[model samples]
Target: MYKELFIHRLVQSKEPNTLPKLLEGLFEVFADFQGITTESVSSTLIDLTFLEEIRKLSGNINIAFGKTLRDIKCTVNDSDFRKHEIYLRYDSVKKLRIVSVDLPSSSLNKQTYNTIEDVITAFLKQISNLQSYFNELENIDHHCVVMEPIKPLYKDDYRNIRIDDKTWLHLEVTPDGSATNVHLIGQSEIWQDKLQKGLLTWDQDKNIVENIYTIFDIKNQSVSPTLIPVDAARKQSSEDTIGPTCGICYCAQLPDYPGLPQPLCQNMNCDVYFHKNCLFQWLVACEGGRPPAFGVINGSCPTCLQPISCSDKDC
Candidate 1:
């Protein structure tokens, strides 16, 4: 039995640049499904359409990015041939559809899926390119910041984030400084209580005013499946370009910037790359006469007086 994963009500966009963001909002609306990953099952190739859309935007939006990414599709196989095929498509009109089907068995030796769960798991593995697509979608380039999951920034201990985790919350701080789309993961019933009463504050300074806390009211909150607008995800705009070497440490091998391969220079002129830790130490040193650093900063480009690359999305 196959069903249609339909994205309800399509919205037209005149600007291609805004498509990615719309796509983002679209997924946020249906972020409540539970998908599992299983290896043994034979599956079909997934659609690659939506992903192509993301790639184009990823190049322009330069926060932190992952090469891998998003897509659509349908088909059938014979009885014995237990084949699982999936495809992703992004039409010129801007709609995404994922359709699954089971055909009659072909041969006696071919394996067949015994249950829908088995089929679903195989389907997830095929479409598991989310981490990459999202990596770029939430590119700090699109907003004020993507608070790291590091200590003092964002902290959580609800283990079991595997592809199969029954209950989880994949929080993405929206442009409005709110986690509007809490990927309600596997099941909301399980984690709703904790999220409502948990001590979840955004910064190290947990004082009510100093910290950006998250309020969870499962009963009152409404985050419809939404679209991702690319207006907020474009690449560097000349002034944000930076050097190949760290202006401070003169280093190229910057510490791993999570999803990014290396640290980026935000200076208009390309000069250096730096380990974030190195950059932080340098920034701290520069603020010698200043008080203990408080929040993140978008330092000025030594040459242009503009903000540097990968510093802060808002700058």
Candidate 2:
């Protein structure tokens, strides 16, 4: 009975020849599965190379510019690096986008970013430098009268610097610190014609702030005193009533003038002070709306009716 049971169990297990073949086939199947897994892991490593580098680079960036590093979004391509004054972000895994008040998405050259390390390094360097430039622009915006706020004056990157009523400059500052594009737009055809003929040129070596300030010479000029209202002027005048009042506005200081009313007349007999701007406009109106030549307006003083010449430069 034990021998019969043993034989029954052996038969149920397998035929010996068939069992070896089945074991060999199973081993081959397992080998193929292992090969497939190895190949998949190798492919995954190749794909995760960029991912790993980016993750490591992000760690470094978080350490360096922790304050400027506003947010790290877990998206495919929209991580932000916000600042109080500027709008900056990573437009992609490899590109940085900078958007300021009026400036557009200025990107560095593609060749500069070959690795993830390169991308982060370049972005941090650019943003660091931009802080100084942005400060300069803000200073100019608040103080400089020769130029309006640094804005895209024309299509694309051309900036406008208005030196005077009729004279301006269209300037383009490159993001990569390359050569700048500067074109002078002037008051008259002669200036434009000279620029076109290459007779008049802009010096690229000069600093932009220096160039604009030199054009109007506002750097050495002092900030104008705030406009004194009628009651304030009267109150101040009660204490000190020595200063000459403007012939036109009847105020001690004009709102937009850079300084006190100029003694344009220069005649001791008249002794009437007039804001250069007011005197110029009055003289221009008297002369049938034709401004005088050579930045000098030859007209009689309104109070004295004496021949007086006012320089437009003072205006």
Candidate 3:
């Protein structure tokens, strides 16, 4: 069933661009659905109105067929043109529209069409793999350290103990230099009843005052989540514009510093920066605990959400 179709103006090209070639290429792909050979599909072209709509939908005019074109107007070399916005519209049945537009004489050549066709073919192949494409989108919600915390210095007095021959004692020194140690009196049930929690004393400034200890209530303790500010992200990037910015935070600006851990996202378009400590905590928070370091792969730019890749050169 043929209906009225519209085509938009072609983009000005130094050589023939992909628009026309893509249309021709799609004819082959759609032929199977229409039960016809590529040659049998009519090459009938449409008008400028169609092109205008296409420009509206996709920000870029250069796209392959089967991709929905939006309604919009675009300017090429100061000339106004309209392109079809949506190409594939389904109401009750599927339909394909073809539009004809002028190609620059200087830009037209055999090679240009072939290149355009190749691009279209590749794009179509990707489209055919719908399940894979969706899988990628589904996987995009990921967490990574845009910034890692600098290791806090530990006090010299604190020492780890091997409880029994199997279990090791877990010890933590507080900011005030007070040490909290959990000891295993024994593995047996009777010995477990004899276990006692130990605490070291500290002065007003939090310095160790004495070795006198007491049992600690380890079960009732609550820790607060660290607050990460947006400004910190910018500061890191500002330190070195050349370095990648944090994907979680977008505040780092200009001339990246050396020796600092590389940022998560570096692309100028997505320019997000993060503090090392902030990022590490964020990863742990998102996963409900500290996750293994190796699981993280790619990270998204905090600003644009576009995936950022590691680069050898500074941004």
**Which has the better TM-score: candidate 1, or candidate 3?**
1
Error of 3 at 35 (Å): 36
lDDT of 2 at 313: 76
TM-scores vs. true structure, each candidate: 0.21, 0.31, 0.19
> 51-150, model 1: which lDDT tens digit per residue?
3434453231221111112232222232323333434332222333333222112121132343223433454443342333222233332332222222
Q: Give the alpha carbon lDDT tens digit for every residue of 35-146 in model 2.
A: 2332343321112233345445543243211122221222111123333232334333344443332233545443433354554455555555554344444444444432
**Candidate 1: RMSD to truth:** 21.7
Best by TM-score: 2
List the candidates ranked by lDDT, beginning with the highest.
2, 1, 3
Q: Tell me how many clashing residue pairs each candidate has.
A: 52, 0, 54
**Which lDDT values do the candidates have, in the order given?**
0.32, 0.45, 0.31
Model 1 alpha-carbon miss at residue 73, Å: 26
| Per-residue accuracy of model 3 over 197-305 as CA lDDT, tens digit each | 2232223332221221112212222311222222443355347555534444443432343223232333433324454444554545545765545645344444566
The reply for model 3, stretches above 4 Å from the true place, is 1-118, 130-134, 138-224, 227-315
Supply candidate 2's per-residue lDDT for 85.
Answer: 30
TM-score of 3: 0.19
